[model samples]
Target: MMSALEADFGQTPSQTVGPYFAYGLTASQYGYDFDQPFDAVLALENARGERIRVEGRVIDGDGNVIGDALVEISQPDGEGRYPQTVDEARSSGFRGFGRCGTGTESGNRFVFHTVKPGAETSGEAPHINVIVTMRGLLLHTFTRIYFSDEAGANANDAVLQSVPADRRGTLIAERVAQDGAVRYRFDIRMQGDGETVFFDV
Candidate 1:
C-alpha cells in the first residue's frame, strides 16, 4: 500500500516548483457518497515544514460547497498499512510502498487536496491508483484502494481485473459516511493492504 496517496491532474504546462520541506501527506479522503462535486485546496508546506493555511471547499452535486469541510493529513508513509518502525518512520517515512522527497521538477513529485476520485468509467468501481515517492526510494510506484460500496465496479475495473482474483480484494476500501458526507478512508498497508505487493512503471 502506498502511503500519502494524493491526486493531481497532469500539469497544465505552466506549473513550476522549487525545493521545500515535506510536512507529510494532507488528508483529502472523501466522506461523501452522493454525486458531490467538491473543490478543495489543502495547505502546502513552507520551507520550514509549517502548515500554511489553505481552504478546501466541498462541492455539492450542484457544484457548490454544501458547507466547507477541512481535512488534516497524517504521515503518508506506513501508518500500519505500510509497516515500518517509529524510528524508521521518522528517518525515512515510507518503508513499504514508497518514500518522501524534497520535491523534484520531473514527473515524480505530486501533491493535491482534491476529493477521492470516483472510479473511472464506473461509479461502483471504488478505487484509485497511486504513485508513491518517499525517502531512500527512487521510483514512482503503483497501488490501489477499492470501495466497499461498489462491489460490482470493483469486480469490473480493468486494472483490478488485471491482478489475480484473490489479490483484487486487497485494494478495496471500506466506505463509511457520517455527518451527511461520504467517507472512504482506506489506508494502504505496505504489506499489500496488510500483505500484498504493489507496482511501479
Candidate 2:
C-alpha cells in the first residue's frame, strides 16, 4: 500500500522543539528549586559602564506576544573586552551573558539588566548578540541589538551595514529614559510586518 513517495524514501517529519525551555534552562525563574546557570541580570553593582535595561516581547506573525519564548544574550563588557578568566568576571561584576524567559514577566517581555556594550572593533558598533527559542521552531534564530543612540558607530558597523538599508531598523533598539532609569526596547518580530532581521549564522 506504499505510494511512490513513501516507497522511494520520503523526507522525515519535522517536530516542534520548544515551549518546554523554562523547565530545564530557566527553572529558577519558573519557581523550581534548581540552580540556574544564568538569569536576567548580567551585571552586578560594581560593573563598569552605563547600566541599562533591555526589555521587549517576542511577537508572532499574528502580532500576539509569545509568552513561552526564551531569550539569551551575550556581549563583551563596556570596554569592548570579554573576561578571559573567572577572577576577571568576578572583579568586574559583569558576566557577559544572560538568559530570560517571557512567561514570568508581565506583557511577556524579556528583560536584561546589564551595562551597555562597547564596540568590539574600530569599525563595529556596540551591540548585544541575541538568540531566540520558542515553540514550533525546529531551530533557534539569531540576531543583534544595536542602540539607537549609537548613530555614528552603527553607521560604520560592518555587520549592520551589510543588511539592506530599510531592514536595518529592525535590529536597532530604541533608547528610552523613564523614572530616572535607562532602558532600551528591542522587540523581536518573528514574521509578518517588521520582521527582525535574523542572521544565517
Candidate 3:
C-alpha cells in the first residue's frame, strides 16, 4: 500500500488529442444537436472585404489524410479591424473566427468561408491564424495561412521572414480558381518532408 503523499508523486501521463473536438467543440459538424459556437463560415454575404475560401486537408507523416482533425481560425476584417462586440459582429456579419472538422466534408478536407484580411499593422501581413487539433497530438499546433498572391506583403511580413526561406513555402496557401470562386489550398503535413512550420505559441 502506498502512503497518501506517495500516491500523488508520479508524473501525470500525457493524453492524446482525439475526436472529441469534432463531437464537442465542433458538435454540429458531426450531427450533434448541441449548439455550436462557430462553424466554417466566418464571413457572411454582407461581410466587408473580398470573399475567399480557405480549404485543405491534414496529412499524417505517411501522407494519409486525417479525417478527424479539428481546425480553427481567427482573422480581422478587410480593413484590419476586428469586431469588438457582438453587436458589431452581427452588424458586419463577420465573426472573424471559424471552426471546422475534416470528417464533415468529402475528401477529409476542412474549409472556411472568409474575406481577405488586410495588414493589421505595418510589420504584419494579411494572414489568418490557425490552430489544429487531432488524434495522437498531445497538444494543439499553431500555424498561419498566408495568401500566395500577397507577394509584396508576405515578403515584408516579419513572421514570415523569420521562417527559413526553403521552409516558408509550407506556410503559403496556393491560389486557385474553381467555378468562378476564389479558393486557397493549404494542406498541413504533420511530419516528414514538407512538414508545415508550426509556431510554439
lDDT of 2: 0.91
| lDDT (10s digit) by residue, model 3, range 104-159 | 79999999999999889987889999999988777899999999999999999999
- 1 against 3, candidate with superior TM-score: 3
Arranged by TM-score, best first: 2, 3, 1
Cα RMSD, each candidate: 20.2, 5.2, 6.0
lDDT of each residue in 1-201, candidate 2, tens digit only: 988866866323332244577457989998998799999998999988899999999999999998888899999888988778889989989999999999989999999999999878888999999999887777899999999999999999999999999999999999999999999999999999999999999
Clashes of 1: 22
What is the Cα-based lDDT of residue 29 in candidate 3?
83
**Model 2: how far is 169 from its true place, Å?**
0.5
What lDDT score is found at residue 189 in candidate 2? 99
What RMSD does model 3 have? 6.0
Instruction: Please list the residue runs of candidate 3 whose C-alpha ends up more than 4 Å from where it truly belongs after superposition.
Output: 1-16
